[model samples]
Target: MTLSELIAQFRTLAFDKVEPYLFDDDSVIGWLNEAVKEACIRGQLLHECDDVDICQIAIKAGQVKYPTHPQLYEITHASLELTSINGGKRTPVCLVSFEEMDKADRDWRDDQDKHRLDPYFLIQHDTYVRLSRPTDEIGVLHLEVYRLPHKMSNDDDVPEIHLAHHEHLIDWALHKAFGVPDSEVFDLNKSEMAEQRFTNYFGFRPDSDLRRITRHDVPHTVKPFWV
Candidate 1:
């Protein structure tokens, strides 16, 4: 596409016409590419949630990595765009930002202790590599998303609302991106479909008892809460 056309497409995507798609496995790395590159330029992208921990890992080992939010947004957006044009379905997904990561502090700290650092650093990381592949191809995976204005509980906060709204747009864009099948999408309860598909894609597994204990005792656990 021409640069102007690309920019127009991006504008449509940025202005509530699209949503993000994410992966279940980091090793797949099918979604990384332009998103991470864009994030690197925007300064919102990070290699790891905690650079200090990544540094430590690098000191001990030869390589280290993490995820960035912008990259996730970019890949999910790109994936949806690719799929939409190529006749595939799109799913709603988001990158865990520092704040989103912070919300699940207990889980993250525990992961740090066990894995030596949290794996699946950010959505950005996934798209970074995927976008860079020489084949100029994108991967396909299952996704389910819902319509907007998610019902909130009495105590839900502002960030949650913003994230939810943005996520909804990303989902909408996925349909545009993938030519989502009318039969397979948005006919039944959207939220139910999202939850069902998400659970199916992510799967459910019990956390280890030892990991739970470590998660409870991780130092400076609240630091990320403010992020």
Candidate 2:
């Protein structure tokens, strides 16, 4: 549904269909943005692989880290791309938790091997990617990731997510509408119910589902270097 359509749905479902609506267009759109973001983050709806700015990261020699996509919700897979006669050569880079690295080798941080290429990436603070070691050469990491929603503007705007999930957006907006504090539309019971429906369809927001998706990427205790 378009922004206007979704707003109308929110009004109808929220029982503010008459004149002087309890929820304004701008307000409902704000709730929509939040809802879509939650849907994308939790359901991994807006997965991207070919978007250059989002799926590609340039690397400079000696740099061990790089800023990830601004709207990156989570990284699913990462591969290193190096200059090659065939244009570019891509190699899989393992993803691991710091604790796993610590368990395998306490001296993991001491490697500081300037001669080594980035072999792994650690998700740091949800904004920057920490490399296993400093880069020996310039390259890029091709990534597959789920991204936050694009902000919708006026009524003409549309959501980036697929049309299949459009009607579902209304549930979240209704949840927000019913939860409006100090507002005429506020209803705690309805708010909870709406939220429950949204969650039931989209599932809860993921904390770190990437780990489960890439469990094999974790280094083994006996063969830590193989990763």
Maximum-lDDT candidate: 2
Give the per-residue lDDT digits (tens) of candidate 1, residues 60-112.
Answer: 12122323332122222212222323354433223344444566663553343
Q: Write the per-residue lDDT of candidate 2 for residues 1-227, one digit (tens) a residue.
A: 78888888888788888878777778888999998898887788888888999989898888877898798767778888766312567877767767666776788788877654335555444678877776667888888887887899878778888899889888998888888896666799998999999999899865565534443365335735654
Give Cα-based local distance difference scores for all models. 0.29, 0.78
Question: Residue 8: error of model 2 in Å?
Answer: 0.9
TM-score of each: 0.17, 0.85
Return the number of clashes found in candidate 1: 25
Roughly what TM-score does model 1 have, to 2 decimal places? 0.17
Worst 10 residues of 1 by lDDT: 53-62
Model 2 misplaced regions, further than 4 Å: 84-88, 116-125, 208-227
